[model samples]
Target chain A: MAPSDSDAIFSALADPTRRAILSLIGEHEELTAGEIAAHFDSLGRTAVSSHLRILRLAGLVAERRDGRFRHYSVTPTPADAVVAFLTSVYQNSLEQLASAVQGAATSEDTPAGRVEERSA
Target chain B: MGELILNNELRLEACPSELFALFGQGDAAVGWLFGSEAPLLRPGSLVRLALPLGGLARSPGTARVLSCQPNRRIDLMHETPWAGRVVCRFDPLDSGGTRLRVRVTIDDVEVARLGAELGLLGGYETGWWEVPLGLLISLSGPAGILGRSTANCAQLAVEEINADGGVMGRAVRLVVGDDATDPGVGAIAMRRLCRTPGLAAVIGMHSSATYAVTAPMAVAKGIPYLYTPTSEPTAEHPLLVRFGETPMDQLHRALPLMAAQTGGSRWFLAGNDYSWPRAVGATARAVIERMDGHVAGEGYLPLGSQNFEPLLAAIQRSGVDHVVSSFVGQDHVGFQRDFAASGLRDSIRTFAPLMDDAVVEHLGESGEGTWNALGYFVALDTSENREFLRRYSDRFGSCSPPVSAAAEGVYEAIHTWARSCRAGGGVEPTALLSGLRRSRFNGPRRCTLGGSLESLLLGEATRSGVRVLDELPAATQAS
Candidate 1:
């Protein structure tokens, strides 16, 4: 709902490596941080850790201790912040469009020549 | 390639003996290459070719020749698709089918390339389209001989497509199976789907059990199993195609909607005790887990159980907020009736993606207000479904399919297999599977199958080669 949470989620997704991380999770089901870091093209473990940390902080992922390894899962459809934003934006636009179209149609004072049913 | 040509291009590997079948028709150099019914040469005309090995290649295209000498010269000609003219002049031996000096001058390069790849010389076109057709033809009969004749939609589609020139001018031969919904029998049925000579892809398997067992066969053998059932997730192998539905693809869309609707993070799962149930259950578990929901309880039972008193009691106990039931066949009927009678209907509603017309219609009042994972609902508001229902009711005495089971998928599989066979450059399973994967068809449902091996999942492929609706159309489906 706030600007800060949006920045956090978008910033976490900003890196190309993070995008690649999302795809890896999709393909392999779930992966530990170490296992995910293993898929990178020569990126060191520390760098991967920061990326994972960013994802964790943004609530995009949740970590569980698997023995010595900390495995992560994409916080299933993450509805806390980012999903809420996208949902509200699209929902509001749809609502506004409906009102605008309804307003135009019922306005009898408008010229008949200008009045036309727009393909929604 | 369309359904027409694909049906005729049979499986080359299963029946190895097809390579040496003797249909006792005289060799027309051209006639022997193609089948005898080719419109290339005149009747009783003699076309000869110089041999690669030795002697003169003498051949008559469907001619009634009187006498012939040994090893030096011979005569016969029949119009065939293999070549314009075929001359097989044999130096007469003692007995049996002669090993003649066969020389074939084929006019088409594409035809020659296809022939060379399959290692077949001039055996494609021949006969009165019925004589030789009845020879090895005794092997696999024309479509609808599995004899139920309950659904000849695939055959009708094949014939129609063939009449319109076929996928590359080959005739598709659709095959019928008695899957009986057993896994092992389904596997065997799938084998016949691929290995039977001249069949393109197998547009068969109405049971998820059959498709699951057969999915491996299609993948290992490189035969495209065009699942038209619309509910099995058969996209695990490149050769496995779903012209139907997989629950995961559906749930990815439906659960999101349901979650948004109920705002509940808890759900329940139930299905008949079979391969489909377990696999789909596991998938649902995974999906719910992914969607941030907890599975409250799941119920599994063999197909024939009539008593649902305890399962109903369990759901009540679990306090599960949402439920999904994956039951097929008469079980759907029994469950609906029992569910209606259970008095738990108000408290425990379910979403079943596929329930047949037979069960739903039979249920009458009981079927009201229930949601099924439906590609084609009896009351579907779409024009396509309305027309299909009308035609089906007029033809088979039902507005909707007896059950959506694999009926349409089977119908689509037939067409898909036929089409794949036609488009397959050569009559090989690998090519046919690839061809079928690349196809998308508009049928009773919007059906498409991908060639990617991961798409060959048996548990979730649908008939008509489309992704089975995995979930209700709310959260994930693009409106």
Candidate 2:
């Protein structure tokens, strides 16, 4: 994934309100703007509406429009992409760890070190 | 490997409802399970698990809450890199407390793969490909009290670097070793770190005694070693970069200001008998003499000396109105407590060059009215400092140890090295050396690496923590 896209997703997920909104929408199939706003007493309808817009822009939420109201639901794509990116970064780190230990084992030429490395 | 199930049970002193309330309180209560500053927990919320291997390497896996049943249980399903389930059950015990059972079920193959990948069980070999940095800091002995917060700051830097795409598109991993605050142990740790494959650089936050031994090893191994605590200025080496405050950096402006406030100039110098403290005494004498101040007494004791009666008696007899103490760690705390207990604190004020948040925290009420000058303080009010503290608290939880100059120096040192690597186009020793010579980073302190002068702040310790008093003028030259 492009760095910018990943950054956008992360930035969107960084906010607590947006994360709560995502979780709320994910708990059900879909929720109208009014329904989501009702869950947050401190946030007004317009404030919740703007949060949904930002989440939609980051591709974290999908919007569906009926005659008079719009419904929002969590999009699995961005979450999946975030997990994939994190997984790759971690795997790369582990690969580096393996190489470091192996390099140390090769340099020492000690049977005990090699045996411990294998067992570890 | 097909499947693996790990089960653990613990009986806690809290009731089931009390135990359940902890999870909902915030990250500070549950940071051991979830990474710090995790999103609010409810069904369907995404939670990031803390990294494995004590956070030495990053392997963050995201999980989705499958169900949360009030005080009874909470279930989560791992969503990436592997398929897994974590079930946490709280059972109210008849005996009084709560019995908590946690069962984690995952694919056995994935577990083995992760272990092998972390090099716990070595199987695959590839050429050195990632930027591996070494952190050699004191984790035991006199200076060990500051170890956890210092290491946390370094880890925060690495995570932030990775979040920002890492150094030159390569992920950075930290390899930590304990120096035990002894030069001999430091030398061994330095040698081991220097021997790591493709080690980019090493950052040391231990004493100058350790640096005297470890810096040479890093230089010999062709690795750039950034020393991140106050130390005596040594002859420049290409591979050695000193990023902390020098004695002159702390004394030049602070001495005159402190003298003006106290209305007298009879000064007593005290510190642990080490190279750094000796250098501090020399610089304090020079600065005090330039201002026509009188040096009434001076003393040096071995590190970790708990009995300060002799020192307190000497201070009382010397009739000094101001003291410049260079003691560190437990000695710093012990001396201050004894100074206050001796009732001398009411008469003579202390100016400590090596004072920091951790030391001040340990000093508690005895720390009040003491003065400190450093490159960074936890109370420093700046946008960069606020953001730095926010990220720090987010990563380590708000209740973690406050940031000290030593810890902040580690954070800045790592970022400075990363910036230099970017400027030099690679992590080669010579290129990085040249880049470091001109590297400047905007952190809590706007620092210019290898520069003679740096921005220093004067702070007075209060009951809570150090409060920034004023910005001291930069010294004319390195002492």
Each candidate's interface RMSD:
29.5, 19.8
Candidate 1 yields a Cα-based lDDT of 0.45
**Whole-structure CA lDDT of model 2:** 0.70
Q: Score the docking of each candidate (DockQ).
A: 0.01, 0.01
Q: Residue-wise lDDT of candidate 1 within B47-163, one digit each (tens)?
A: 221111101221111221222333333333211111122243433223322222333232343233222111122223322221010001000111111112234354456565667
State the C-alpha lDDT per candidate.
Answer: 0.45, 0.70
Predicted candidate 2 versus true structure: per-residue lDDT over B113-216, tens digit per residue: 33322112222222365688988886545676566678789999999888988888998888776565656556645655665678899988999988987887
- Least lDDT summed over 10 consecutive residues: which range in candidate 1 chain B? B131-140
TM-scores of the models, in the given order? 0.47, 0.61
Which has the greatest lDDT? 2
- How high a TM-score does candidate 2 get? 0.61
Candidate 1 stretches greater than 4 Å from native: A1-120, B1-150, B166-170, B188-195, B218-222, B230-235, B259-265, B289-292, B356-358, B378-405, B419-427, B430-434, B447-479
